[model samples]
Target: MARPSEGAARGKPRKIVLVTGGGGGIGRAAAQALGTGGRHVVITDIDASAACETRRLVTASGGTADIVEANLEIAEETANVVEHAAAKGMLAGVVHCAAVFPQRTFARATITDFDQVMGLNFRAAFLLAKAAVPVMEVKGGALVLLTSGAVRLEGADTPFQRPFALYGASKAALDRWALGVAPELRDRGIALHTLTPGAFVETPGTRRIDRRAIPSLPIVPARQVGEAIAWLARNPRMSLAGRRLDATAFGHTWGPG
Candidate 1:
Protein backbone atom coordinates (compact mmCIF):
# COMPACT_ATOMS: atom_id res chain seq x y z
CA MET A 1 0.00 0.00 0.00
CA ALA A 2 1.25 3.48 -0.83
CA ARG A 3 1.85 5.67 2.23
CA PRO A 4 -0.14 8.86 2.75
CA SER A 5 1.16 12.38 3.40
CA GLU A 6 1.78 13.58 6.95
CA GLY A 7 -0.85 14.58 9.53
CA ALA A 8 -1.35 14.57 13.31
CA ALA A 9 -1.82 11.06 14.52
CA ARG A 10 -0.95 12.19 18.05
CA GLY A 11 1.43 9.30 18.64
CA LYS A 12 -1.50 6.98 17.96
CA PRO A 13 -1.96 4.96 14.80
CA ARG A 14 -4.26 6.34 12.13
CA LYS A 15 -7.72 4.85 11.83
CA ILE A 16 -8.97 3.61 8.46
CA VAL A 17 -12.30 4.50 6.85
CA LEU A 18 -13.59 2.58 3.83
CA VAL A 19 -15.54 4.48 1.19
CA THR A 20 -17.40 2.91 -1.70
CA GLY A 21 -17.88 5.00 -4.88
CA GLY A 22 -14.92 7.11 -3.84
CA GLY A 23 -14.09 7.65 -7.47
CA GLY A 24 -16.15 10.82 -7.72
CA GLY A 25 -18.87 13.10 -6.38
CA ILE A 26 -19.85 12.80 -2.71
CA GLY A 27 -17.73 9.72 -2.16
CA ARG A 28 -14.65 11.59 -3.25
CA ALA A 29 -15.48 14.40 -0.88
CA ALA A 30 -16.11 12.02 2.01
CA ALA A 31 -12.81 10.27 1.48
CA GLN A 32 -11.03 13.61 1.44
CA ALA A 33 -12.85 14.67 4.57
CA LEU A 34 -11.72 11.55 6.39
CA GLY A 35 -8.21 12.13 5.19
CA THR A 36 -8.31 15.69 6.50
CA GLY A 37 -9.32 14.28 9.86
CA GLY A 38 -6.10 12.19 9.85
CA ARG A 39 -7.70 8.87 9.05
CA HIS A 40 -6.38 6.54 6.39
CA VAL A 41 -9.27 6.34 3.93
CA VAL A 42 -9.71 3.31 1.71
CA ILE A 43 -11.45 4.51 -1.44
CA THR A 44 -13.03 1.84 -3.63
CA ASP A 45 -15.08 1.95 -6.82
CA ILE A 46 -15.82 -0.35 -9.74
CA ASP A 47 -13.90 2.08 -11.88
CA ALA A 48 -10.24 1.71 -10.90
CA SER A 49 -9.32 4.98 -12.55
CA ALA A 50 -11.91 6.95 -10.64
CA ALA A 51 -10.82 5.46 -7.32
CA CYS A 52 -7.27 6.39 -8.25
CA GLU A 53 -8.30 9.97 -8.89
CA THR A 54 -9.87 10.12 -5.45
CA ARG A 55 -6.67 8.78 -3.97
CA ARG A 56 -4.78 11.46 -5.86
CA LEU A 57 -6.98 14.19 -4.42
CA VAL A 58 -6.68 12.81 -0.91
CA THR A 59 -2.91 12.60 -1.09
CA ALA A 60 -2.60 16.07 -2.60
CA SER A 61 -4.66 17.43 0.26
CA GLY A 62 -2.14 16.01 2.77
CA GLY A 63 -4.44 13.17 3.73
CA THR A 64 -3.80 9.46 3.29
CA ALA A 65 -5.82 7.02 1.18
CA ASP A 66 -5.61 3.62 -0.50
CA ILE A 67 -7.45 3.03 -3.77
CA VAL A 68 -9.06 -0.33 -4.49
CA GLU A 69 -11.14 -1.24 -7.53
CA ALA A 70 -14.10 -3.51 -6.93
CA ASN A 71 -17.36 -3.88 -8.84
CA LEU A 72 -19.84 -4.15 -5.96
CA GLU A 73 -22.41 -5.90 -8.17
CA ILE A 74 -20.40 -9.10 -7.78
CA ALA A 75 -20.67 -10.60 -4.29
CA GLU A 76 -17.10 -11.76 -4.39
CA GLU A 77 -15.91 -8.31 -5.36
CA THR A 78 -17.80 -6.72 -2.47
CA ALA A 79 -16.31 -9.23 -0.05
CA ASN A 80 -12.90 -8.59 -1.52
CA VAL A 81 -13.13 -4.86 -0.83
CA VAL A 82 -14.37 -5.28 2.76
CA GLU A 83 -11.91 -8.01 3.62
CA HIS A 84 -9.07 -5.95 2.25
CA ALA A 85 -10.11 -3.01 4.39
CA ALA A 86 -10.53 -5.20 7.46
CA ALA A 87 -6.94 -6.23 7.02
CA LYS A 88 -5.96 -2.61 7.36
CA GLY A 89 -4.99 -1.39 10.83
CA MET A 90 -8.44 -0.41 12.05
CA LEU A 91 -11.91 -0.34 10.49
CA ALA A 92 -13.15 3.09 11.53
CA GLY A 93 -16.23 3.39 9.31
CA VAL A 94 -17.71 2.89 5.85
CA VAL A 95 -19.16 5.55 3.57
CA HIS A 96 -21.33 3.61 1.17
CA CYS A 97 -22.00 5.84 -1.85
CA ALA A 98 -21.86 3.16 -4.50
CA ALA A 99 -25.35 3.37 -5.96
CA VAL A 100 -26.94 3.71 -9.39
CA PHE A 101 -30.19 5.45 -10.31
CA PRO A 102 -31.37 4.17 -13.68
CA GLN A 103 -34.09 6.09 -15.54
CA ARG A 104 -36.41 3.18 -16.38
CA THR A 105 -40.03 4.03 -15.73
CA PHE A 106 -42.21 1.43 -14.07
CA ALA A 107 -43.91 0.63 -17.37
CA ARG A 108 -40.59 0.22 -19.14
CA ALA A 109 -38.45 -1.36 -16.38
CA THR A 110 -37.67 -5.06 -16.70
CA ILE A 111 -36.96 -7.82 -14.21
CA THR A 112 -33.28 -7.44 -14.92
CA ASP A 113 -33.54 -3.77 -14.09
CA PHE A 114 -35.16 -4.56 -10.75
CA ASP A 115 -32.48 -7.13 -9.96
CA GLN A 116 -29.67 -4.72 -10.70
CA VAL A 117 -31.36 -1.99 -8.70
CA MET A 118 -31.97 -4.09 -5.60
CA GLY A 119 -28.62 -5.82 -5.87
CA LEU A 120 -26.63 -2.61 -5.98
CA ASN A 121 -28.73 -0.51 -3.63
CA PHE A 122 -29.80 -2.92 -0.91
CA ARG A 123 -28.00 -6.23 -1.29
CA ALA A 124 -24.59 -4.62 -1.46
CA ALA A 125 -25.26 -2.63 1.72
CA PHE A 126 -26.31 -5.81 3.49
CA LEU A 127 -23.24 -7.70 2.37
CA LEU A 128 -20.83 -4.93 3.20
CA ALA A 129 -22.33 -4.47 6.65
CA LYS A 130 -22.19 -8.21 7.24
CA ALA A 131 -18.53 -8.37 6.32
CA ALA A 132 -17.55 -5.30 8.35
CA VAL A 133 -19.56 -5.99 11.50
CA PRO A 134 -17.12 -8.49 12.97
CA VAL A 135 -14.07 -6.33 12.38
CA MET A 136 -15.80 -3.17 13.54
CA GLU A 137 -17.22 -4.95 16.56
CA VAL A 138 -13.67 -5.06 17.84
CA LYS A 139 -13.40 -1.28 18.27
CA GLY A 140 -16.83 0.22 17.56
CA GLY A 141 -17.32 2.30 14.38
CA ALA A 142 -19.87 3.89 12.12
CA LEU A 143 -21.54 2.53 8.99
CA VAL A 144 -23.04 5.34 6.95
CA LEU A 145 -25.85 4.52 4.49
CA LEU A 146 -26.79 7.02 1.79
CA THR A 147 -30.58 7.11 1.69
CA SER A 148 -33.25 9.11 -0.15
CA GLY A 149 -35.87 11.69 0.69
CA ALA A 150 -37.91 9.85 -1.89
CA VAL A 151 -38.81 7.42 0.85
CA ARG A 152 -40.33 10.33 2.73
CA LEU A 153 -42.40 11.35 -0.31
CA GLU A 154 -42.98 8.08 -2.17
CA GLY A 155 -46.70 8.29 -1.31
CA ALA A 156 -46.97 11.39 -3.42
CA ASP A 157 -47.27 10.73 -7.17
CA THR A 158 -46.30 14.15 -8.40
CA PRO A 159 -44.70 14.45 -11.85
CA PHE A 160 -41.17 14.66 -10.44
CA GLN A 161 -41.84 11.51 -8.42
CA ARG A 162 -43.50 9.14 -10.90
CA PRO A 163 -40.27 7.96 -12.53
CA PHE A 164 -38.93 6.79 -9.17
CA ALA A 165 -40.95 3.62 -8.65
CA LEU A 166 -38.00 1.26 -9.10
CA TYR A 167 -35.29 3.48 -7.62
CA GLY A 168 -37.45 4.64 -4.76
CA ALA A 169 -38.47 1.12 -3.86
CA SER A 170 -34.88 0.02 -3.85
CA LYS A 171 -33.76 2.91 -1.63
CA ALA A 172 -36.77 2.48 0.61
CA ALA A 173 -35.65 -1.09 1.17
CA LEU A 174 -32.18 0.21 2.01
CA ASP A 175 -33.58 2.72 4.49
CA ARG A 176 -35.61 0.05 6.24
CA TRP A 177 -32.85 -2.51 6.10
CA ALA A 178 -30.38 -0.09 7.61
CA LEU A 179 -32.81 0.84 10.38
CA GLY A 180 -33.58 -2.79 11.07
CA VAL A 181 -29.90 -3.50 11.54
CA ALA A 182 -29.04 -0.30 13.41
CA PRO A 183 -30.28 -1.42 16.80
CA GLU A 184 -28.46 -4.73 16.54
CA LEU A 185 -25.25 -3.01 15.51
CA ARG A 186 -25.65 -0.41 18.24
CA ASP A 187 -25.44 -3.18 20.83
CA ARG A 188 -21.95 -3.77 19.47
CA GLY A 189 -21.00 -0.05 19.40
CA ILE A 190 -21.46 0.49 15.67
CA ALA A 191 -23.87 3.25 14.67
CA LEU A 192 -25.82 2.56 11.49
CA HIS A 193 -27.65 5.53 9.97
CA THR A 194 -29.67 6.22 6.82
CA LEU A 195 -29.36 9.77 5.51
CA THR A 196 -30.49 11.74 2.47
CA PRO A 197 -28.79 14.79 0.97
CA GLY A 198 -32.37 16.11 0.46
CA ALA A 199 -32.47 16.81 -3.28
CA PHE A 200 -31.29 15.59 -6.64
CA VAL A 201 -27.51 15.52 -6.63
CA GLU A 202 -26.01 16.28 -10.04
CA THR A 203 -23.88 13.24 -10.59
CA PRO A 204 -22.79 11.70 -13.88
CA GLY A 205 -25.99 9.69 -13.84
CA THR A 206 -28.28 12.59 -12.96
CA ARG A 207 -26.56 14.80 -15.53
CA ARG A 208 -27.84 12.50 -18.26
CA ILE A 209 -31.44 12.89 -17.19
CA ASP A 210 -33.52 15.80 -18.42
CA ARG A 211 -33.16 18.32 -15.59
CA ARG A 212 -36.63 19.53 -16.49
CA ALA A 213 -37.95 16.08 -15.66
CA ILE A 214 -36.61 16.17 -12.10
CA PRO A 215 -38.40 17.87 -9.23
CA SER A 216 -37.52 21.41 -8.31
CA LEU A 217 -36.58 20.27 -4.82
CA PRO A 218 -33.98 21.77 -2.49
CA ILE A 219 -30.49 21.07 -3.83
CA VAL A 220 -27.26 20.60 -1.91
CA PRO A 221 -23.68 20.50 -3.13
CA ALA A 222 -22.15 17.04 -3.41
CA ARG A 223 -19.42 18.08 -0.98
CA GLN A 224 -21.98 18.85 1.71
CA VAL A 225 -23.08 15.25 1.54
CA GLY A 226 -19.46 14.25 1.73
CA GLU A 227 -18.84 16.43 4.75
CA ALA A 228 -21.96 15.03 6.37
CA ILE A 229 -20.69 11.48 5.88
CA ALA A 230 -17.42 12.36 7.51
CA TRP A 231 -19.22 14.09 10.37
CA LEU A 232 -21.49 11.11 10.80
CA ALA A 233 -18.44 8.90 11.04
CA ARG A 234 -16.57 11.13 13.47
CA ASN A 235 -19.53 12.08 15.60
CA PRO A 236 -20.88 9.59 18.13
CA ARG A 237 -24.27 11.11 18.90
CA MET A 238 -26.46 8.08 19.50
CA SER A 239 -29.49 10.36 19.41
CA LEU A 240 -29.10 10.27 15.64
CA ALA A 241 -28.82 6.51 15.60
CA GLY A 242 -31.42 4.23 14.00
CA ARG A 243 -33.01 7.29 12.45
CA ARG A 244 -33.51 8.72 8.99
CA LEU A 245 -31.73 12.11 8.84
CA ASP A 246 -31.94 14.86 6.29
CA ALA A 247 -28.72 16.60 5.35
CA THR A 248 -30.19 20.07 5.62
CA ALA A 249 -31.24 19.38 9.18
CA PHE A 250 -28.14 17.66 10.60
CA GLY A 251 -25.29 18.04 8.12
CA HIS A 252 -24.46 21.75 8.32
CA THR A 253 -24.26 21.70 12.08
CA TRP A 254 -21.22 19.45 12.35
CA GLY A 255 -17.66 20.29 11.44
CA PRO A 256 -14.72 18.02 10.72
CA GLY A 257 -12.76 17.01 13.82
Candidate 2:
Protein backbone atom coordinates (compact mmCIF):
# COMPACT_ATOMS: atom_id res chain seq x y z
CA MET A 1 0.00 0.00 0.00
CA ALA A 2 1.21 3.50 -0.80
CA ARG A 3 1.77 6.01 1.94
CA PRO A 4 -0.92 8.71 1.80
CA SER A 5 1.41 11.59 0.98
CA GLU A 6 3.27 9.66 -1.71
CA GLY A 7 0.03 8.95 -3.54
CA ALA A 8 -1.31 12.46 -3.00
CA ALA A 9 1.90 13.97 -4.41
CA ARG A 10 1.44 11.76 -7.49
CA GLY A 11 -2.27 12.63 -7.94
CA LYS A 12 -3.79 9.40 -6.75
CA PRO A 13 -6.47 9.28 -4.09
CA ARG A 14 -4.77 8.13 -0.87
CA LYS A 15 -4.77 9.34 2.73
CA ILE A 16 -4.32 7.85 6.18
CA VAL A 17 -6.77 9.23 8.74
CA LEU A 18 -6.71 8.41 12.45
CA VAL A 19 -9.97 8.34 14.38
CA THR A 20 -9.56 8.47 18.14
CA GLY A 21 -12.34 7.10 20.35
CA GLY A 22 -13.37 4.92 17.44
CA GLY A 23 -15.25 2.56 19.70
CA GLY A 24 -18.63 4.00 18.77
CA GLY A 25 -20.73 7.08 17.88
CA ILE A 26 -19.15 9.95 15.92
CA GLY A 27 -15.70 8.39 16.06
CA ARG A 28 -16.81 5.10 14.53
CA ALA A 29 -18.86 6.94 11.94
CA ALA A 30 -15.83 9.02 10.91
CA ALA A 31 -13.63 5.94 10.59
CA GLN A 32 -16.24 4.41 8.31
CA ALA A 33 -16.67 7.60 6.33
CA LEU A 34 -12.97 8.10 5.70
CA GLY A 35 -12.27 4.43 4.98
CA THR A 36 -12.47 4.85 1.22
CA GLY A 37 -10.68 2.30 -0.94
CA GLY A 38 -7.79 4.68 -1.26
CA ARG A 39 -7.84 5.77 2.36
CA HIS A 40 -6.44 3.80 5.30
CA VAL A 41 -8.15 4.43 8.62
CA VAL A 42 -6.54 3.79 12.00
CA ILE A 43 -9.16 3.25 14.67
CA THR A 44 -8.11 3.68 18.30
CA ASP A 45 -10.19 3.67 21.46
CA ILE A 46 -9.92 2.58 25.06
CA ASP A 47 -12.54 0.00 24.29
CA ALA A 48 -10.66 -2.67 22.41
CA SER A 49 -13.78 -4.54 21.36
CA ALA A 50 -15.49 -1.51 19.87
CA ALA A 51 -12.33 -0.44 18.07
CA CYS A 52 -12.06 -3.92 16.61
CA GLU A 53 -15.69 -3.74 15.58
CA THR A 54 -15.12 -0.38 13.91
CA ARG A 55 -12.30 -1.91 11.87
CA ARG A 56 -14.53 -4.82 10.94
CA LEU A 57 -17.34 -2.52 9.83
CA VAL A 58 -15.10 -0.36 7.69
CA THR A 59 -13.36 -3.33 6.09
CA ALA A 60 -16.72 -4.93 5.44
CA SER A 61 -17.73 -1.75 3.60
CA GLY A 62 -14.81 -2.27 1.20
CA GLY A 63 -12.54 0.25 2.84
CA THR A 64 -9.14 -0.35 4.43
CA ALA A 65 -9.07 -0.28 8.23
CA ASP A 66 -6.81 -1.06 11.17
CA ILE A 67 -7.36 -1.12 14.92
CA VAL A 68 -5.17 -0.13 17.86
CA GLU A 69 -6.43 -0.12 21.43
CA ALA A 70 -5.33 3.00 23.27
CA ASN A 71 -6.20 5.07 26.30
CA LEU A 72 -5.83 8.67 25.22
CA GLU A 73 -6.40 10.18 28.66
CA ILE A 74 -2.78 9.42 29.39
CA ALA A 75 -0.79 12.16 27.64
CA GLU A 76 2.07 9.93 26.56
CA GLU A 77 -0.29 7.33 25.15
CA THR A 78 -1.73 9.90 22.77
CA ALA A 79 1.73 10.31 21.28
CA ASN A 80 2.14 6.55 21.07
CA VAL A 81 -1.11 6.20 19.13
CA VAL A 82 -0.02 8.82 16.62
CA GLU A 83 3.42 7.26 16.35
CA HIS A 84 1.94 3.84 15.64
CA ALA A 85 -0.13 5.19 12.77
CA ALA A 86 2.71 7.29 11.39
CA ALA A 87 4.87 4.18 11.28
CA LYS A 88 2.53 2.69 8.70
CA GLY A 89 1.90 5.77 6.51
CA MET A 90 2.01 9.53 6.31
CA LEU A 91 -0.99 10.55 8.39
CA ALA A 92 -3.41 12.56 6.29
CA GLY A 93 -5.58 13.76 9.18
CA VAL A 94 -7.15 13.00 12.54
CA VAL A 95 -10.70 13.15 13.88
CA HIS A 96 -10.56 13.48 17.66
CA CYS A 97 -13.83 12.33 19.19
CA ALA A 98 -12.60 11.07 22.51
CA ALA A 99 -14.41 12.99 25.28
CA VAL A 100 -16.07 12.54 28.65
CA PHE A 101 -19.18 14.45 29.52
CA PRO A 102 -20.15 13.72 33.10
CA GLN A 103 -23.63 15.16 33.40
CA ARG A 104 -23.27 16.54 36.90
CA THR A 105 -24.36 19.85 38.34
CA PHE A 106 -21.75 21.83 40.26
CA ALA A 107 -23.62 21.17 43.45
CA ARG A 108 -23.54 17.45 42.89
CA ALA A 109 -20.09 16.87 41.47
CA THR A 110 -16.73 16.80 43.22
CA ILE A 111 -13.38 18.43 42.43
CA THR A 112 -12.11 15.07 41.17
CA ASP A 113 -15.01 14.89 38.74
CA PHE A 114 -14.07 18.24 37.29
CA ASP A 115 -10.42 17.17 37.03
CA GLN A 116 -11.24 13.97 35.21
CA VAL A 117 -13.55 15.67 32.72
CA MET A 118 -11.06 18.40 32.00
CA GLY A 119 -8.27 15.89 31.59
CA LEU A 120 -9.93 13.84 28.88
CA ASN A 121 -12.09 16.47 27.24
CA PHE A 122 -9.64 19.35 27.09
CA ARG A 123 -6.12 18.35 28.10
CA ALA A 124 -6.12 15.37 25.78
CA ALA A 125 -6.59 17.63 22.73
CA PHE A 126 -3.62 19.74 23.73
CA LEU A 127 -1.46 16.62 24.01
CA LEU A 128 -2.67 15.19 20.72
CA ALA A 129 -1.90 18.44 18.91
CA LYS A 130 1.56 18.57 20.38
CA ALA A 131 2.27 15.07 19.14
CA ALA A 132 0.55 15.18 15.72
CA VAL A 133 1.60 18.62 14.50
CA PRO A 134 5.27 17.65 14.05
CA VAL A 135 4.34 14.61 11.97
CA MET A 136 1.86 16.61 9.90
CA GLU A 137 4.49 19.29 9.33
CA VAL A 138 6.32 16.78 7.09
CA LYS A 139 3.30 16.61 4.78
CA GLY A 140 0.23 18.68 5.63
CA GLY A 141 -2.86 17.14 7.20
CA ALA A 142 -6.03 18.21 8.98
CA LEU A 143 -7.12 18.04 12.64
CA VAL A 144 -10.81 17.71 13.31
CA LEU A 145 -11.69 18.35 16.94
CA LEU A 146 -15.21 17.67 18.06
CA THR A 147 -16.84 20.54 19.91
CA SER A 148 -20.37 20.84 21.29
CA GLY A 149 -23.22 23.26 20.76
CA ALA A 150 -23.90 23.04 24.45
CA VAL A 151 -20.95 25.33 24.97
CA ARG A 152 -22.16 27.87 22.41
CA LEU A 153 -25.58 28.44 23.91
CA GLU A 154 -25.22 30.04 27.29
CA GLY A 155 -26.99 32.68 29.46
CA ALA A 156 -30.18 30.79 30.07
CA ASP A 157 -30.28 30.01 33.74
CA THR A 158 -32.77 27.30 34.51
CA PRO A 159 -33.00 24.38 36.90
CA PHE A 160 -32.03 22.13 34.03
CA GLN A 161 -29.08 24.23 32.92
CA ARG A 162 -27.05 23.39 35.99
CA PRO A 163 -26.66 19.80 35.00
CA PHE A 164 -24.48 20.65 32.04
CA ALA A 165 -21.98 23.02 33.67
CA LEU A 166 -19.24 20.44 33.99
CA TYR A 167 -19.66 19.17 30.46
CA GLY A 168 -20.10 22.56 28.86
CA ALA A 169 -17.07 24.08 30.53
CA SER A 170 -14.73 21.43 29.14
CA LYS A 171 -16.03 21.84 25.61
CA ALA A 172 -15.81 25.62 25.86
CA ALA A 173 -12.18 25.28 26.82
CA LEU A 174 -11.55 23.15 23.72
CA ASP A 175 -13.37 25.59 21.42
CA ARG A 176 -11.17 28.41 22.66
CA TRP A 177 -8.05 26.33 22.08
CA ALA A 178 -9.11 25.43 18.58
CA LEU A 179 -9.49 29.12 17.63
CA GLY A 180 -6.09 30.00 19.04
CA VAL A 181 -4.24 27.27 17.09
CA ALA A 182 -5.69 27.72 13.61
CA PRO A 183 -3.18 30.33 12.51
CA GLU A 184 -0.24 28.30 13.73
CA LEU A 185 -1.51 25.20 11.93
CA ARG A 186 -2.01 27.18 8.69
CA ASP A 187 1.68 28.04 8.68
CA ARG A 188 2.51 24.36 8.32
CA GLY A 189 -0.06 23.75 5.56
CA ILE A 190 -2.23 21.90 8.06
CA ALA A 191 -5.84 22.91 8.47
CA LEU A 192 -7.47 23.06 11.88
CA HIS A 193 -11.25 23.18 12.26
CA THR A 194 -13.75 22.42 14.99
CA LEU A 195 -16.95 20.50 14.30
CA THR A 196 -20.20 20.43 16.28
CA PRO A 197 -23.15 18.16 15.74
CA GLY A 198 -25.47 21.17 16.23
CA ALA A 199 -27.96 18.88 17.87
CA PHE A 200 -28.19 15.83 20.03
CA VAL A 201 -26.95 12.48 18.81
CA GLU A 202 -28.12 9.52 20.81
CA THR A 203 -24.89 7.76 21.62
CA PRO A 204 -23.40 5.82 24.50
CA GLY A 205 -22.74 9.15 26.17
CA THR A 206 -26.09 10.85 25.51
CA ARG A 207 -27.97 7.72 26.41
CA ARG A 208 -26.38 8.06 29.83
CA ILE A 209 -27.87 11.54 30.21
CA ASP A 210 -30.90 11.97 32.42
CA ARG A 211 -33.17 12.84 29.51
CA ARG A 212 -36.42 13.18 31.39
CA ALA A 213 -35.65 16.60 32.87
CA ILE A 214 -33.17 17.97 30.34
CA PRO A 215 -35.82 18.97 27.74
CA SER A 216 -35.61 17.61 24.26
CA LEU A 217 -33.10 19.17 21.88
CA PRO A 218 -32.93 18.84 18.11
CA ILE A 219 -30.82 15.96 16.90
CA VAL A 220 -28.54 15.42 13.92
CA PRO A 221 -27.82 11.99 12.57
CA ALA A 222 -24.30 10.76 13.42
CA ARG A 223 -23.82 9.63 9.83
CA GLN A 224 -24.15 13.21 8.60
CA VAL A 225 -21.47 14.53 10.92
CA GLY A 226 -19.27 11.56 10.06
CA GLU A 227 -19.44 12.33 6.34
CA ALA A 228 -18.73 15.99 6.99
CA ILE A 229 -15.55 15.13 8.90
CA ALA A 230 -14.49 12.82 6.09
CA TRP A 231 -15.17 15.59 3.56
CA LEU A 232 -12.96 17.93 5.53
CA ALA A 233 -10.20 15.32 5.78
CA ARG A 234 -10.29 14.52 2.06
CA ASN A 235 -10.27 18.16 0.97
CA PRO A 236 -7.67 19.37 3.52
CA ARG A 237 -6.39 22.85 2.54
CA MET A 238 -9.22 23.22 0.03
CA SER A 239 -11.83 22.95 2.77
CA LEU A 240 -12.60 25.77 5.15
CA ALA A 241 -10.17 25.81 8.08
CA GLY A 242 -10.06 27.92 11.24
CA ARG A 243 -13.85 27.77 11.37
CA ARG A 244 -16.24 25.84 13.53
CA LEU A 245 -18.80 24.08 11.30
CA ASP A 246 -22.15 22.89 12.54
CA ALA A 247 -23.41 19.61 11.18
CA THR A 248 -26.66 21.08 9.88
CA ALA A 249 -24.73 23.60 7.79
CA PHE A 250 -21.85 21.37 6.63
CA GLY A 251 -22.99 17.78 6.38
CA HIS A 252 -25.76 17.63 3.83
CA THR A 253 -24.10 16.49 0.60
CA TRP A 254 -20.87 14.57 0.63
CA GLY A 255 -20.71 10.81 0.36
CA PRO A 256 -17.42 9.01 1.04
CA GLY A 257 -14.76 9.83 -1.57
Pairs in steric clash, model 2? none
Across residues 170-196, which tens digit of lDDT does each residue of candidate 1 receive?
A: 889999888787898899888888879
Error of 1 at 192 (Å): 0.5
Model 1 / residue 90 / CA error / Å: 0.5
Task: List TM-scores for all candidates, in order.
Answer: 0.91, 0.90
Q: Deviation in angstroms for 162 in model 2? A: 1.9
> Candidate 1: lDDT of 72?
87
By how many angstroms RMSD does model 1 differ from the true structure? 2.6
* Residue 216, model 1: Cα distance from true site in angstroms: 3.1
